[model samples]
Target: MQKPLAYRMRPTSIETIVGQQHLVGPGKIIYRMVQAKMLSSMILYGPPGIGKTSIASAIAGSTKYAFRALNAAVNTKKELQIVAEEAKMSGTVILLLDEIHRLDKTKQDFLLPHLESGRIILIGATTENPYINISPAIRSRTQIFELEPLAAADIKTALKRALTDKENGLGHYSVTLTPQALAHYASATNGDLRSALNGLELAVLSTAPDPKTKTITIDLPIAEETLQKKAFSHDADGDAHYDVISAFQKSIRGSDTDAALHYMARLVEAGELVSLMRRLLVIAYEDIGMANLPACARTVNAVLAAEKLGLPEARIPLADAVIELCLSPKSNSGISAIDAALTDVQTGHSGEIPKNLKDAHYKGAEALGRGVDYQYPHNFKGDFVVQQYLPNNLKKKQYYEPKTNGKYEQAFKIQYEKLKKLLK
Candidate 1:
């Protein structure tokens, strides 16, 4: 039996490689490095199926070095040392460590001494931000080449190659891809080449039973059926992190209790940590502002309870906070008011400070009538002195507009009324 399309279609040379032109294009840094045989210990940081491993293989094949591949997920420090010793015997060894970010600081430190000696040209791959996951010492020694997701056009080209190239491709199948079908496959894979090829292969194998007909057609619906379920909840990196959180925040903002709950469930079901959920809860206050002050308090309480209670049981406090935030009366611009005031001050929109509110220690300032008209709120009727506190240009600018239904609204209304009567 023939090998799978993903395996069969692996590029043997740099010329046959798909996508990632930014790294391997004519006159690119990687191209120049490969050509000069001046390759450094580097990290290939990117999403899956973007030719990281393939590039490493091509580099090994093109150069005069022995290639050694190991997965950090399965390999141990002892195994790494063994490989380093082997590289020392061999003139130059290109050690390709897949998912290198999985190594903890101690395990990663094992490679530093070997890398410093130039025994092995370390080529590592990771789906995460190296700055966050990789050890600082190891990271500083290796140059990082960021690989991007394959474009739709690149995926299309790959599909065409799989259909035509006879050596390892599915040329014998006589499959034809419609533009719509190609787009469906591309969109479904989200620039993952292996996934795209797997999806395409599945579509062809399932749909085309007879190769004698010499024609096969694939559509979005068929593609959807073949790729029935979304493999994982989140995309590579944290691309979906902000997206999921945004949806959660918006659901609460819109006061859709059910929607809020649903989004909360999605995050939890997707294996998002309770701590991240709590962090988002805190942001709900700053973003939601006085529109729902209870939201902020509830969020804080939920975080504290979650920390104390832990998971499963802790999920309850999180859900309660979400519901409370959704139901609470909303306001706007509480935090923004302070921000605007500060911006005004920085931009020179500020005028003279009220004498009573200013420093009282300045010599002769009090004698010059600075505090002559100042009225202390504590000494006035109802503790309500309606004095001008804003700079001259912003005196008429009302920053804190209270909502009509919340506790703050009631308090603000009462205070405003008493202050108006007292000042008059």
Candidate 2:
């Protein structure tokens, strides 16, 4: 059986790997490790099709070590044992274990000894974060290298190489890919080189050659059809779901409109209406708290409108709310005030309520002196009186410290100082 274009085009040397210059560039850790031929257990983690498997294979090729590739999602303990046995016979075996996140505990335990003994040089490839998914023991034992998405220029260079390589690519066939079609594939795939390469191959193979010239032509329409906008891996209930939401909230809180919008676009693309709406509401109250009352109300109204409209149309209202919240003045004084009060209550600092402030109309006899000293604040000017609201022991404690972030909070701060002096 013939291998797929991507598989066949795997870089056999470290120098040929297109992207991730941070790792595979000259004098980098991976480059140095491969050059020195001193291998160790490590994990290469990133998104799909950015050359995790190719890097592992290329490492083995460079060092001229025995290479074995296995899928951790399916391979059994017996299969690992065979590889381990082969490593014992052969000096060292470079094992490229893909989907290391799904590797069973039993297999992981079985491979620990070999890894420590330098018998098997383990190269685990995973798209998920190793810190989140891999076992702590394995994680501690391996050097973790994070790979980023490929740039458009890198993908373009790799595509051009494949187009002209006569051995494993579509170079032998008479094909013409216009510059527009090439740019479309490079950018539209969203940093996935595998998608770009596969789309290019499909565009060339599926198009009929012209009778006179016998050449396959790939234009913008063909490129668009072949590379139907790369679907992002946004599982609603998965790690990506929480990651994007966290980034979204942080961006809004940090007042970064561009980053906030990027995350919002991801949520909108994934149709995550409920999560986005809830996050926006929380940001309005939590981050934008007490800074601007009207802004908060507007955010609440926007959330309601989004909820009523549903997705596709809902994203617009939510985006409006997000931008408003991002640009608005930020203050967490409301949440901070409540948290301080809660802490006092939970940590035994809460004291008894003042007798004058207690409920006096609820079946209280006047003889008990419950309402004897209580004076109605309405009778005083500004509905204010010099009366103790907190217990005697906690009279000096202040909870709400309004910040001068927005106009409303600034006004509150000025009025609050005057009121504090008058009450005292």
Candidate 3:
């Protein structure tokens, strides 16, 4: 049976690999390792279709070592045993384990001895951040290399090469790809070579060849239809999920409405409503606090509506909240002030509360000097009075440094400065 176009086009050697020049280029680490025949186990981390597996396949082909592919989350311990046995027989073998972050203790334990003996060179591939997702046991045994996305020019080059490749590509097919079509394939996928190549194949096979020339002419429209939506994989547990969430928050914090909406769209596509709502609430208080008090309340209302509505419809309120938050004035003084106070409390710097501020409701409270000499502010003119609220050790400490980010917070700054001067 014929494999998929993507699988068939896998490069056999490092020289043919489309991207990842940092590692696969001449004089690079992988190139040097293959040239010296000094191969070691390593982990290749990056997004899908960006050549993590290609690097592993190329290394195996270059070194003439046995190559085997397995998914850590899908393959069983028996499968791992087979690869290890082959290593024992063949002197050495290269095992490309995908989603290595999901490797369990049993399979990992079995592979550890073989890895230690240098019999099995493990090439772990993942879309997750290894430092956060993978266990230390497997991580310590392997070197980690991150793959970068293929450039548009690099992808176009690969696509052109595929068109002429008869054995594994569409060389024999009577296909005419226009310049506009080529540009769509290169740019529409957002630097994904696999999507572009395979999309080309689909367009070629699906389109009808003209009766006269017997040529399948792929135009811009066909290219767009073939790849209507770019490949999206947002595993909630993966690094991509966190990366998008981080971007969504930072864009809002930086007051970039468009960028915030873009990331929110990705999260919506992944159906991460719970995470989205929770983060919006946090951003409201942490980033948009005090500056726009109404914005904080509106964000809460929006989150509640989103949680109650759920999905498709839920995105309506969320979109409204995201736009408002992105445009809202940003201030971190509230969170910053609290964190500073927290740091002091955590470091054991919390001295005793002032006697005047201590509880005095109990019958014997006054005997302990609680609430003694307490000047009631309400009984004074203007209903304002100066008193030491903080403990003696922190009497001079000022944590809340208000900013005039918005009119509401500006008023706060005025009042705060007035009180500060009075206390001094």
Identify the candidate with maximal TM-score: 3
List model 2 lDDT by residue over 140-211, tens digit each.
889999998787678889989988989999899988887777766665555678988999988888999999
Q: Rank the candidates by TM-score, best first.
A: 3, 2, 1
Between candidates 1 and 3, the one scoring higher on lDDT is 3
lDDT of each: 0.74, 0.85, 0.87
Clash pairs of candidate 2?
none
Model 3, position 123, has a per-residue lDDT of: 98
Off by over 4 Å in 2: 230-424
- TM of each candidate vs. truth: 0.55, 0.62, 0.62
Worst 10 residues of 2 by lDDT: 230-239
Stretches > 4 Å off in candidate 1: 1-3, 104-109, 210-214, 229-424
Q: Write the per-residue lDDT of candidate 1 for residues 41-127, one digit (tens) a residue.
A: 999998788889888887887785888889988988888888888887887799999998887676677888888988889999998
After aligning candidate 3 to the native by TM-score, how far in Å is the CA of 102 from where it should be?
1.6
Residue 291's C-alpha lDDT in candidate 2? 88
Alpha-carbon error at 140 in model 1, in Å?
1.4
